[model samples]
Target: MAKLVIYLNCEDARSQAAFYTEALGGEILNMVTYEAGPWSDMPEKDKNKIMHMTFTAGGVLFYACDSIGEPIQRGNGAFFYLSFETEEEAYAAFDRLAVGGEVIESLKVQFWGDLFGQLKDQYGVIWQIAVENTSPSM
Candidate 1:
């Protein structure tokens, strides 16, 4: 059986998914545009809006979706991304995510020999994204 997947919620689920997909070397797995259907209860004008989106990036399953009502308050309370590749991934991810949310720390080569950074997505979910400068021994 396939493993369970995780997801992130945002104001524009599709846009957020796209942002993460670009940053994490991932693609939009699926998208649900709230159009004239049950998924979209809003007016026809809002039909083109994205209700939800998912992606598979960096071998990890990521999820995102738009906010239906009062937006959820999110923050980088205390979470970081642990990576296993070159600093490029960290740098790229930071650049992509920064499009929507604020960057608390820019991604850069760390003295400890790794690329690391932190930021909040459009939805306010705090994450620690990083990529080890050293390649792991097979």
Candidate 2:
């Protein structure tokens, strides 16, 4: 139905959004910038900034936005998961992603017969990549 994501406010929202779009092959639905406040009551700063953005990748819809006013407290939330169809795909992606990051876990035979690994990307986003060995229908 719906999904949500939080994006840190970086100096360049457009560029950051593009990078993520390319990396995940997600659809960049909207990328717009408007002049500050003469038109709306909201602060002018936010007008030129990315107030919000939406993307759809791999059959999933995700939302992102620029952080405002404060530093985001990192590493206090649940880990995010990304799944690959095959173990090979997962390891390949894991290697590519590890260029600026380190592999928290090298691909290995998981207790469930699938291979899995954990990593924190260059941008500080932690992910758990895995292959599903068991059928969900069971």
Candidate 3:
């Protein structure tokens, strides 16, 4: 099976990882600075930036690093979608992610029979949270 990992670029990847851990519920697996290795050729400022970091949240893997050239932009054609097994879990995540972030859509049952909502996090990342509807049909 193939694996998909989201690699994000941030102004301060180290701090971003911390915020992600607190908001998204994850543990940082590993982190590396650019002081050495292939990134040694980088400038002193870039050397201290996060070269790479791995985090795991709800069994999902994520990678993040600081940009070497152009900074990251908020404009998007993509966003992360998190699916939950229970409505409570979905709601809790939505609430937590909404702190200091913009809620594009409040959480609610949708026409598709699922609880869904969208938000843009403080880090400029967009997210869509959903939980399958288990209620019986009327």
TM-score of each: 0.65, 0.70, 0.89
Q: Rank the candidates by TM-score, best first.
A: 3, 2, 1
Full-model lDDT, candidate 3: 0.85
| Number of clashing residue pairs, candidate 1 | 4
Reference-based TM-score, model 2: 0.70
* C-alpha positional error of residue 91 in candidate 3 after TM-score superposition, expressed in Å: 1.3
Q: After superposition, how far is residue 107 of candidate 2 from its true place, in Å?
A: 2.6
- TM for candidate 1 is 0.65
lDDT, model 1: 0.68
- Full ranking by lDDT: 3, 1, 2
Where does the lowest 10-residue lDDT sum fall in candidate 3?
36-45
Top candidate by TM-score: 3
lDDT of 2: 0.64
The C-alpha RMSD of each candidate to the native structure, in angstroms, is 4.3, 3.9, 2.2
Which one wins by TM-score: 1 or 3? Answer: 3
lDDT of each residue in 1-138, candidate 3, tens digit only: 988899988888887788778776889999888875574467877778887899976657899988888967877798999999988888988888888899999999988788899999888889999997778354
Candidate 2 vs candidate 3, lDDT winner: 3
Q: Identify the runs in model 1 with alpha carbons over 4 angstroms from their true place.
A: 1-4, 34-51, 77-82, 108-114, 121-123, 132-138
**Where in model 3 is the C-alpha error above 4 Å?**
39-41, 134-138
| C-alpha lDDT score of every prediction, in listed order | 0.68, 0.64, 0.85
Candidate with better lDDT, 1 vs 3: 3
